[model samples]
Target: MQPVHIILLIVAYFSVLLFISYLTGKSANNKTFFKANNSSPWYLVAFGMIGASLSGVTFISVPGWVESQSMSYMQMVLGYIVGYAVIGLVLLPLYYRLNLTSIYTYLQDRFGNYSYKTGASFFLLSRTIGAAFRLFLVANVLQLLLFDAYGIPFWVTVSITILLIWLYTFKGGIKTIVWTDTLQTLFMLIAVGVCIYTISTEMQITNIFSYVAESELSKTFFFDDVKTGDYFWKRFLAGAFVAIVMTGLDQDMMQKNLTCKNLKDAQKNMFWFTIVLVIVNFFFLALGVLLTDYAQKNGIDAHKDQLFPIIATKGSLGLATAIFFLLGLIAAAYSSADSALTSLTTSFSIDILEIDKKKNPEEQEKTRKKIHILFSFVLIATILVFKYFIADQSVIAKIFTFAGYTYGPLLGLYAFGLFTKLQVKDKAVPFICIIAPVLTFLTNYSTIQYFNFDFEFFVLVINGVYSFLGLFLFKK
Candidate 1:
């Protein structure tokens, strides 16, 4: 496809999103933006969340990850099922009982003002960097495939990308995202389905079972190596905690769940979302096998993160496959990005600014609008900064590693709050949270250097344990 055609495809896609925003943003207020007035359909939210949960990182990186890790990522996917169940059974009821606009507010009610700010600040730091990384992947791809053809700088491309997200989500917020995300999820799934079918036809695999039987990359279990990243128990446990911290504890994710009408609806959403997410992830791994096979047979020299894009855009995947890839990539990227932007806006406005206590309704809305735009620029800056420092590693792996450090404090804080009734010296909460990640990092480094034991996602567990201990020691 020509660069102009790709540009047109993106323009048409955003037009549809803007229309959804216009419809949803009508008469939207702080309630609608933050909570969607508790009116989102449970099923729509569930379906939409698959895309938001996967994001562009998964859409692009997970398939490529299969080359190195094979189907071992499924270990984490299975763990997510357990994590989501815990969220529905434990966390959802608490949030609903509290009638929370921001899930982090639970920290305040359970601990104190300092703990509340600490939790929300961690979320802001974690999601800001995480979301920026995801968007950076998509923006970098666009820069490579389209903008470089026109000599556009990376920062310009990133700014344009963030600006478009702000335009659609600036008014309706979560209200718009519930609907837009559903549409984007549909496109993402269709793109994956079509790519799978097209590749199967190209490979001349008449039987699906036969294809799996022939491929070595389809192997899923990895119990043999306790020291490696692919250990089944290690991956499974890490996956469970990751889902707990990244989705259940995350404001970016739980904001959609909060939009559902009640706890029952939110729980229903989590159940079905978990099921679909597992199935979709399985297909992504399958696609990875196909892409890697296609690359080897065709003598395409690409590995890790470069595998999928190299074949889709540069190799002989055909024009239709290219179009679907572009569509799927954008759909997946924006579905997550749009919601992250809204949730960041929601968190900062309510948690950090205390817009409710500090301002009248009219002023609260005004302040929210300003914060929403501010975060868009924040996202752009973070993405540009990432461009300077990020090295050639699996983006998905980097995201998870980064999460282990950033979200571990959150996991510990929440676990301590829910499982124990002890109140910490509230003023010390922020210090404990800050110290936890640094200590976790130093422990990881020392263990890797001396013990030759590389902790994968389990680093999150370590971080959480450290934070929990810190909180316990500081208890009043």
Candidate 2:
């Protein structure tokens, strides 16, 4: 755990990434920069997507979650499968049929310019915040590794780290992201696997199936009698909504999916993606259960998120295991950090700013580079602002929760356009979309406070309903 070792590991990782970036960026023109010339293999996109889907927030959060609530999150993972199915069958085809450069363009065609901008704006705001929060999670870990371990200043650590992501992704955009993300996913899965092995070995639970089954944490699904608060139905609904909004409806996630050669491949990729997600999440939760049991037995004190890292860094793990664990963590963060950067730029360019129509490929490429730089700065600012002003550890989570309000509108608007023939007034669409989420939040808040109603995982459901109602009210 020497500071220099951590620095060297980071440098080595960046050096290789830089080499990859230079190699890829060399031939990058507008098409290749934006969509990898639509030449990426669907399977590669699917594998690369794991890094994007899980990110640093998920990498740390999922494992940490196992230390509490008795490893209950597995209940939601089952629901996630159902959600992905809906996305593949219902959502992906719609996106592909439209042949969209930015999916929000569908809103414009279905409704009007106002609706398109509203949807794109919501995406911009939601994605900007979401990406910032995800990156902040990674930044926090890097800061600890730097200051607590190596005494580097927080600002310097944040700057240097983000700069590296910018350097690599500033040129090739989503094309480079597809390949880099695959690399990241490989690193990420390897990291998760190493943790599973280390924790199981330390517990002397040699048989993977028996260890997971015998351990109290191995309960993968829930059938709670209660109607809410992690109940089976609630968790399932929550998982479905999470998958739909976080994956299907999200540009950041779907942008990679859309890079496939054709919609058939994209659909195939989604199916395989869902299957892989299920297996991967199962392992994370199982690891959580194992880690929790081991800690309880060994009298270890650590936060739920810190539980895995602490054990791997300080526990009975051998040197090689420890190194792999660290590398995995770094890999997960970098994998996500780069994709977020790419997606933010893509959304901004296609959805809001209209970089797709620049006409001249050369100018389009230069404009993209400028936008990438702009977003990198915005992300750095977000991390700094959150670090200094936000005292609550829950603030970041709340930002995500609040940011989620926007997705309800996205879900409702998209569902309305695809499922029904009702025409909406172009001018009023944006207002309806905005008001829907606000009303949903108010209703949700009031229900929880006055009626003794607790909608733990169904917030997005409520959000969709409110948005739908608003659309109905404002329809032409």
Candidate 3:
């Protein structure tokens, strides 16, 4: 596709999105923006969540990972099933019974003001940085495929994308997000479906199942010893814990789950969402196997992450191939990016600064708009900074590795609050949270450097232990 064509296609896509935004905003107000008046259909929230949870990173990076990483993610993802169940059974009821607009409010009721602020602040710090990183990954892909063709600067690319999200969300907030996310999810499904069909045809692979089963990359369920990282027990535990903490405890994710009308509906959504997620992830991993097999047979160089895009544009598949892949890529990126911005706005307005209670509707509206702009700029700037410092693929991966450390405190704080009745010293919570992750990193680094203990993805376990220890020792 030419630069002008891509620009036109994008413009048309955004125009349609803006129209939907306008429609969704018609009934929106302060309450509606914050929680959608608690009227959203449970199924919509469940369906829309697939897009938000999967994101552009999963869409683009996951398939690539399969060819290299022993298909171990499926094991971990199965663990997420148990994690979401815990969230649904335990966490969802608590949030619903309390009638929370912000989940962090639980801290104030249980611990103290300082605890509330500490938990909320940890969310803000981790979420702000994490949101920026997710957007940065999406922006990098957009820059490569779309912006670079026009000689547009990276910041401009980020600005335009963020501005589109802000414009749609400033008024409607969560109300608008539900409908927009559903639409994005639909687009994502269609794009993936189309791409899959196209690849199957181009490769002339009559039996995809046999291809996957016989392929060298088909190590789906790991039942090996726990001593290995990708072993069944480790991946399963990691998957479940990662999901509970990363998705269940994450404001960015739970914000959407909380929009359901009731706890039962939310639970239903969670169960259904899990089933769908398992199947969808399986499909994507299968696609990865196919991509690997096709590339090997054809003597392609096979860059792990870039394999899908390269296969999508191979000459035999023609112009529609590029169009479908671009559309899929856009859908994947925008589905997550738009929701991330909305959650940031939601969390900031309700949690961090408490902009929701300033007692002036007009001023609250004004504050919402200003913060949206502030975060929009922040997302853009982070993308530009990422581009400058970390162009190498390995470095980009490491940046994500570093960002993964932030979620440990989230896991610890929630675990401590829910499982224990001990009254934690509120003022010390934030310090403990911060110190825990830093110490975890130091321990991991030292172990790797001196002891040569090749700690796998179990860094999550290490971080969780560190946070747990910090809370125990620093308890008042």
Candidate 4:
């Protein structure tokens, strides 16, 4: 495909998103932006979340991950099922009961003003970096495949990418995202399904069962090595906690759940979302096996995160496959990125700035608009930083590792709040949250150096434990 054709496709895609935004953003106010007026359908929110949860990182990186980890990522996927169940049963009811616009507000009700600010600050730091990283992946890909051909700069590519998201989401916020994400998720899944069918046909394997049975790379269980990162127990436990922190505790994710009409509907959304997420993830792993097998048989040099793009775009999979790959990549990338932008706007406006309390409704909306645009620029700057510093590691691994440090504090804070009645010296909460990650980092370094033990995602668990203990010691 020519660069012009690809550009045209992208233009058409954004046109649809803008139209959806126009419809959803009509008469949108603070309520619509923050909570979607608590009017979204349960099923729509559930279906749309599939794309947000997977994002571009999974769409591009998961298949590539198969080359190194095989189907072991499935261990985490299985763990997510249990984690989602916990969220629906435990966290959702609490949030609904409180009628919270921001989940971190729970920290305030449980502890004090300092704890509330601490939790929201952690989310801002974590989601800012995390969302930037996710957008960076897709922006880098766009620069490589399209902009470089047109002699455009990487910064320009990123600016355009972030601008498109802001265009759709700046008005309706979560309300627009509820509908836009559903559309993007559909595109993403269609792209994956088409790519899988194309590859299967090329390999002359009509039966997916036969293909899976024959491939060595399809191995899913990994109980043999307790010391390695892919150990089933480690991956499973880490996966469960990851879901709890990243989804249950995350504002970007939980915001969508909050948009549902009520607790019962939200729980229903979580139930169905978990089942579909598991099935979708299984297909991604299956696609990874196929990609790795194809690469090996054809002597493609690419491995890790490079495998999917290399095969889909440059391989002999044909033009249709390439087209779908582009669509899927954009859909998956923006699906999450759009929501991240909104959630960051929500957290900063409501939590950090206390915009709701500090301003009249008109002024709050004005302040939120500015913050939304500010974070969009922040995302662009962060992506540029990643371009300079991020080396050849898998983007997905980098994301998870970063989450281990950033989100671990959140996990600890929430755990302490929910599981215990002891109240900490409110002023000390921020220091504890900051110290937890730094201590977790030092512990991770020492253990790796002396014990030769890799904590991987379990580092999150350690960070949470340290934070929990810190709070316990500081109890008033």
Model 4 lDDT per residue over 102-188, tens place: 999999999999999988988988898888888988988888788999899999999999999999999999999999999999999
Q: 72-111 in candidate 2: lDDT tens per residue?
A: 6777777889889988988888888887767788888888
RMSD of each: 0.9, 2.1, 2.1, 0.9
> All candidates' lDDT scores?
0.93, 0.77, 0.76, 0.93
lDDT of 3 by residue, 274-380 (tens): 99988888888888787777778788886666777777764355677677777767777777777777777777787877887798888987787787788788777
Residue 395 lDDT in candidate 4 = 91
**TM-score for each prediction?**
0.99, 0.94, 0.94, 0.99
Clashes of each: 0, 2, 1, 0
Superposed by TM-score, candidate 2 places the C-alpha of residue 322 at a distance from the truth, in angstroms, of 2.6
Where is model 4 poorest over a 10-residue stretch in terms of lDDT?
208-217
Segments in model 2 whose C-alpha atoms lie over 4 Å from true places: 225-227, 388-400
lDDT tens per residue, model 1, 1-476 = 68998999999999999999999999999999999999999999999999999999999999999888888999999999999999999999999999999999999988999999999999999999899989999998899899999999999999999999999998899999999999999999999998988888888978856686578988898988687878899899999999999999999999999999999999999999999999999999989999989898999999887787778888776999999999999999999999999999999999999997864789999999999989998999899999999899888999999999999999999999999988899999899998999999999899888987778888999999999999999998
